[model samples]
Target: MALNARLEIRQGQGLVVTPQLQQAIKLLQLSNVELEAFVEAELERNPLLQRDDPEPAETAEAPEAPAASSDELEFSDTSTAKADEAMDAEGDDRFADDPCAGGPPLTDWSRAGSGKATDLDDDAYDRALRRELTLSEHLTLQASQAGFTAAEAGIAQVLIDGLDEGGYLRLDFDETAERLGCSPELIETVLLKCQGFEPCGVFARSVGECLAIQLKDRNRLDPAMQALIDNLELLARRDLSALKRVCGVDDEDLRDMIAELKALTPRPGAAFGGEPAQTVIPDVHVRADPLGGWRVELNSDTLPRLLVDRRYHAQVQAGSRSDADKVFVADCLSQAAWLVKSLDQRAKTILKVASEIVRQQDAFLAFGVEFLRPLNLKTVADAIGMHESTVSRVTSNKYISTPRGVFELKFFFTAAIASADGGAAHSAEAVRHRIKQMVEGEGRDGDVLSDDRIVELLKEAGIDIARRTVAKYREALRIPSSVERKRMLKAG
Candidate 1:
């Protein structure tokens, strides 16, 4: 075969994801909180992008006598005159250059504070004032204070990053040494130092071990307690007698020791002195009335109204020097416009999806959990004319605030079980709730209903559930067996 390079022409159609297209798609899928972050990022990157400043106080003037009609008012005071001026000002340069002229701004309604504009310098100042010490930052501070060699500091950094989110040193000593190009002894030495750093018990290997290190720091690790921790599985399984025998303690002493053990925080790494609580700002607020039914409202107060400044955009287009700068500005402006459009579409889609969910699950709103019907991704997808995956993406990690309580979007969708009255399928969650109610209302003196009895009760109510299925549901709900319940009642 002759070796040669040749070009051949062929026609094919395919989709390619350019940066602008990708941004639009991403913006569409973003929940209100995520959209806020994206807009913040764009504001940092593009000088033309800004949170819509409150309409410049409209220059208060004395009001004239009311016009006979809007048509009789001064042309300058009307919106039509302003539109004509905008059209004449841009001329050919309007749509050819600026895409943000007629679009709404990107906004988010999932943040908890009043949406206000702060300058770039203010952002910097805020960051400087409230800097957080990440796991790496804390380690670096410790290493600097300890006065380690440059090589040792580098090795320490690698180990610090290797620590898991829970701040445990999960890497084996040898593996860490190989990656750091140091001996295992050096790695262990650095790990020991890391364990003593701020927050007290970081760089530990396991939860039990983490607690042990903190306890050792405070001189509180008793031999029996340490033994119990080493065999945590036995303790967790309620093998109380076995634990007592192993620790050689009396029942009262064992109980007291167990209580003390419970007080210890196994994940000591989480004790980062003063982290603020995460406040959840709901995207949608829904209320149900006694007779009037449900009403859905978007929390507009949390939304960030962002827009491309038309005034500044014209200045950039008219005063450009380099081709690169022009292209950059155009690209950024396009992105800003697309972001605005995507945001509008996103809001509409979220509202539509929420409305459909409320309509389908109105029974849950009126009555309680027992009235909840079985709903799934396919049903929602079919109703909304969207793919099941799209529905899944919309529901995942997003929450809906409703009359009952704050619930994840997926909470509305449950597997179906045969109903008690044999009318239709009921939600598994609803069935589980009914099982819980029956268990809760059981006679105290008489034998508490076993799984079989519960199944019979469900059958009488018109729900056709098997005994094993009832047992599984009961177990899932954390309800104890009949024997355990009887013992619990006696103890009560």
Candidate 2:
């Protein structure tokens, strides 16, 4: 081996994912809500970036640049303009006039009282002023109402704090009493007092105790009812005969008792507290065109419009003297430009992928699930001249609203199932739907369709699938075996 180092010039081409490219890829995968959050963060960090406000056509004007000296650099707004023009050329008018064109109409309650204030308006105003009371607040108010000595009130508060969301006390009475330097009898007494609060079952230790409290309040806590409450597992299994024997009641009386039990709230505290429900916002909208084709558009309401302020950037850069300040301004300008370009590219890519999906699955939209052809990411990616991974990322967490309903972009891509007659393959989703329909249409008195029988039926319909595959698809659809189905039917 030679000791001296030798220099050689090697020239080749390779793909490199720069920081901006990485950001574009990330933005492509994020849902609309997540992209809004990311853009808001960028707007805060980059001084040259600002949100593009919705302006009327008459009020819109071109942004002007500040006057600069001959020595100062003048930045042009051509890049931003070109990006906007590209987006407009792609499909700006796709959702211009109608915000809710493809989807259902949304009610604007803010403008509901513009005409006149009626009784419903007063009720709405009152509801807007009211706040939902949490479980802890309700319990604290009840504890305050129940008169107790200072020490007893402290113990009662501790017991209330120990209750779980289901209104069951999760703490051991003896351990709590030991920690508080009090006797277990005192703890038990405080617990009993707290159990007398509203909602009927505030401080019970078990499900049986919870039901017992409600039953006692209703004046129905007989020995038979108590026994029935104690054996909840038997009730869940629908073991009617065992419940009847345990409760020592005839069929008619047992039915009445079971109905009463069913009417009682099992989770008494659930109504008071939980996380609020979140609404799903679709990312794309698909509608029928006048020429009998499909029209696809991005949900612009969910997408944030952003622009780079080149005038402000030029002003800042011209005044900076230090190298560090100049570098910071340059970095901000670069980031803002990249972000705007990335957003435009992301929107175009999503629209392209969604349009192709509508084209390929038009049969499904016009007909039904049975006509959904076999599809994959590769097919869509090839049609759109992109990589399969890119298509996958674009489909992740993205939804499209159609005449059929709102569905995820990935919902149309299913594995292929071979056809019995060596024709075109069938979609796995279609096969699963067929299996589900067959199971649902079975009569209670008729013999349940076993996995083998399902395979036979599918083969007769020109679908070549194995018995195990049929069983797998059935299980995925949450359909039980023939024996379990029969047992459930007999029990019913």
lDDT for model 2, please: 0.68
**Pairs with steric clashes in candidate 2:** none
Candidate 1 residues 292-354, lDDT tens each? 767765566545666666667778888989876666566556556555554554454455566
Q: Per-prediction TM-score, please?
A: 0.49, 0.51
Output the TM-score of candidate 1. 0.49
lDDT of all predictions: 0.61, 0.68
Off by over 4 Å in 2: 1-14, 54-276, 368-371, 432-461, 466-492
